[model samples]
Target: MIAAVNDETNLVEKERKIDAIRWNQAEELSTFDYFDINALLAYLVKVNIVARWTRLDDKQGREMLHRLMTSLDGKDLINKQ
Candidate 1:
């Protein structure tokens, strides 16, 4: 499981790098800057999606997911309490 997760993560990283390159190329060709807030938000969304999809059976991934959920729950509890 760890191996599989590692492989998936590596692949995702590669894809991200490729995507970045493509984005840069497109921006260059179109004479546009790729540093806008909307672009950043879109990049973050893409990263999260990739992380979730490539998590596989990784213990670290599970832990991260748990931590994120816990943090959100804590925020909800504080808001409601």
Candidate 2:
């Protein structure tokens, strides 16, 4: 139905917006001279990833962003476990 198609289109658009925001945030984070944990946390919160941002250190932040990017691209690394 037309209504179902419209709903699906809206959902896809929302997902694209979220992905764009996430990638932009990741790119911005990569540009920092010295990591600002608060700024990174704020961006994650804006992208609805607050829970994942808790207690993150610099290494963890970098790893998380990498994983997010890989996942978005359908190319995540395999876990040994």
Candidate 3:
């Protein structure tokens, strides 16, 4: 997984690879603990991963990048959160 992520040249693809690795790890960790708190937490983690990808917007990302680049010349940097 590390090699796959490292081999990915596009930034978005690299991010996707990382997310996939995270999801798989979470799934593996929860595989033997059905109906337990850990399983519930892992389900939440998977849900969050899905939600994150669903909310991804290329236009918003580019706009945020532009804002960040513009702020680099200023005293304070732009904060996304």
lDDT of 2 by residue, 21-61 (tens): 66566656654322477556645653454234423345544
State candidate 1's TM-score. Answer: 0.30
Models, CA RMSD each:
11.9, 11.4, 15.1
User: Relative to the unseen true structure, what is the C-alpha lDDT of residue 69 in candidate 3, on a scale of 0 to 100?
Assistant: 45
> Which residue pairs clash in candidate 1?
none
Q: Rank the candidates by TM-score, best first.
A: 3, 2, 1
Deviation from native of the Cα of residue 42 in model 1, angstroms = 15
lDDT of each residue in 1-81, candidate 1, tens digit only:
233344555675655455445444443453332457654554455446436544653664555456445633546546765
Full-model lDDT, candidate 1: 0.49
Q: Cα lDDT of all candidates, in order?
A: 0.49, 0.49, 0.66
Least accurate stretch of 10 residues (summed lDDT) in model 3? 72-81
What are the models' TM-scores? 0.30, 0.30, 0.63
Ordered list by lDDT, greatest first: 3, 2, 1
**Which candidate number would show the highest TM-score if scored against the true structure?**
3
User: Could you tell me which residue pairs clash in candidate 3?
Assistant: none
lDDT: worst 10-residue window of model 1: 24-33
